[model samples]
Target: MTDSESVRQDTHPSGTWDDIKELPPSAKLVAKVLEHNEAMTQQTIAEETLLPDRTVRYALNRLDEKNTISSSFSVMDARRQLYTLDINP
Candidate 1:
């Protein structure tokens, strides 16, 4: 196999983490938190990461743009959204 392909496989087995690894610090932090937890809201992420609400929002956007994360309306509060890593990627 080609060296580049080998490197890709070695670095990003899921292809999801590799893309997230390239994102900004806040995005990476959010991804890591989600990696451990089943799911969390934007507020929960902000509290867990100790990042500002705005930063958390921005990070979530970045993750969404890369298709690394997915969101669904919260069952507890439809106004709130729950975010989780896209395992299929």
Candidate 2:
């Protein structure tokens, strides 16, 4: 499809995340944040990516469930969870 056609076909504002443009809107937002940063807490990603905390949480959870990335808490904040791309154990 042409760029304009794609625009018409696309359902949401896009390119917020390079790896996520083709993903569903919510997933796209989260993917963008992950792609742009080495790692990010779910909350920080929620803020930077302009998605709700629950949405960010859900997306992160899905990516983790898929084994696309791994997650752990920061040394400083047990409450803060960081997600990083999974290249293998």
Candidate 3:
């Protein structure tokens, strides 16, 4: 399998500690929130985590860069996006 596939198969909400160990505190916090909750929008995340919108946005960007999360346009609101962990494991 390719490297990306390998990483996916080895990661999940419950199994992402290792994968996120090197990430910053904000990223880790964002990841944990995603782990416990289902798909969430950036605003929802900020509310739930009590983090600033800018911080949450930065964390989400970091997670996205790490291939640890994925996002899709929200069905309820076309202008908003829903985020979820890329946990296949």
Candidate 4:
């Protein structure tokens, strides 16, 4: 990879961790859950984390604001968005 690309990759995890550290506890829990799983819908995340749906939604918004997580519409369920970690944990 190019030097810039290498540097970006090397620093991304630490940067992401720093951002995550500033987030609320609920957002941190959501990040942890995404770290362990491949990808999950908000409902699935709520179930896995045992958090309320509203809390999960709030956490997701926080994570998204930090660019620590990415989401895409699920193929099987258009209404559901699958969330995944954008950084390595």
By lDDT, the best candidate is: 4
Q: What is the C-alpha RMSD of each candidate to the true structure, in Å?
A: 11.6, 14.4, 8.0, 8.0
Please give me the total number of clashing residue pairs in predicted model 2: 1
TM-score on alpha carbons, each prediction: 0.79, 0.64, 0.77, 0.80
The per-model lDDT (C-alpha) reads: 0.74, 0.57, 0.75, 0.77
Q: Which stretches of candidate 3 lie over 4 Å from their true place?
A: 1-16
Cα deviation at 7, candidate 3, in Å, is 23
By TM-score, rank the candidates, best first.
4, 1, 3, 2
lDDT of 3 by residue, 2-85 (tens): 122221213334334567778889999999898887678899999999999999999998887777887776655667777877
Tens digits of lDDT, candidate 2, 5-69: 11111122222223333446676567656766776777788888888888888887665544455
Write one digit per residue (lDDT tens) for candidate 1, span 1-89: 11221111111122367787779999998998988887788999999999999999999999888877767766556677777777454
Please provide, for model 4 over 1-89, each residue's C-alpha lDDT reduced to its tens digit, 9 standing for 90 to 100.
Answer: 11222112112322277888989999999999988887788999999999999999999999888888777666665676777788754
Candidate topping TM-score:
4
Cα TM-score of candidate 4: 0.80
* Model 4 weakest lDDT span, ten residues long: 1-10
Worst 10 residues of 3 by lDDT: 1-10
Q: What's the CA RMSD of model 2 in angstroms? A: 14.4
Candidate ranking (lDDT, best to worst):
4, 3, 1, 2
